[model samples]
Target: MQLIRSILAAPLLRSRIASIAQLRRTFSSSTSVSARAFKYVVSRRVKQKPAKKTNFWVKQHLKTGRRIKYPPYPYGDSNIFKRSNRGLFGGKFPMQGHSVSSELEKKNLRRWLPNANKTTLYSSVLKKRIRLHVVASVMKTIKKEGGLDNYLTKDKPARIKELGPRGWRLRYAVLLRLKEQEAKRLRGR
Candidate 1:
């Protein structure tokens, strides 16, 4: 019975020792592989080629000389480069500012203002002229009425009395449009 017990213990100890040795060998080999991989990565990054400088004249020459060939046109002798007589916004002038409300009033105000060169005047200049006039007039009216808060509380009749009939109408329209824009902004529109 003692001999059998010793034999069994010997085999178990040998197996345990063999497993420990295998584990150590595996761990050592994995660490070496990792070290080699890190070195390879570092060496590869260091050995990267420097970027070549491009000549501007050479680039320009290449661009100008290289014309892409297109298939021949089936239709004979059409002038593809001719400018069309059509204007933007279907021949009507485009509105200048971001404010979408009171467009008609803006257009009327623009027409009322005199232009230095009517034929050559741009829509932007016209819009700016109208905007300047409206802002100045409204500011004058506000100042005359004391303040904005006071102006708001006053009745329409009293406000009209402060500014003349035509002046009051224009100021009222401008202020109303401005208020609409502010309300739109507040509502996240």
Candidate 2:
């Protein structure tokens, strides 16, 4: 019985060495493959070059009378190729500061008072305290003339209203005319 047990243990120990040798044959090689192997093995993974991004805005928006490539936009963007903008209410210019409530009257008003002295004009704006739009137009003109800061600064706000309402209305009118002139200027540009 002892001899049989010894014989069984010897076979088991021998199988353990054979198993280790089998593992070494399968996975234990640390030696790097020779560079010469690459000569025969063609690289299957061709370097996948990246696709380029397209810049198509200029071609898309060229000012031509051809059929449009995109849908119309409700808001006019300088870059977009679109038609008239849509609004819930009609007859109102989408641009601010122009009131179409009484277009003809407004046009006449522009003719009636074309110029108001800047000093007196700015003061009237402070007084009528009309809608902020009137003030904004005057400020816009002053800015265009490169003298808004000179005419009215935070420190001079009080002196503005002392100029009176008539003066302010006249200033507002002059601003409207100036804007019209500027519009013509831009159209020519």
Model 1 TM: 0.20
Point out where model 1 deviates above 4 Å. 1-156
Report the C-alpha displacement of residue 18, candidate 2, in angstroms: 99
Listed in order, each prediction's TM-score against the native is: 0.20, 0.19
lDDT for each residue of candidate 2 in 1-189, tens digit (9 for 90 to 100): 997778657977779878888988864467566623566657687888897542222122224644324433223332221111210111122232433445465522222221222232232322222212223344554566464323333224333442233223333344544555688899998
Q: Please write out the lDDT profile of model 1 over residues 72-179, one tens digit for every residue.
A: 322222233111111101111223334334646442222222121212111221121221122344454446857443443355564434333223333344454456
lDDT of 2 at 2: 100
- Reference-based lDDT, each prediction: 0.37, 0.38
User: Which ranges of candidate 2 are over 4 A from the true structure?
Assistant: 1-156
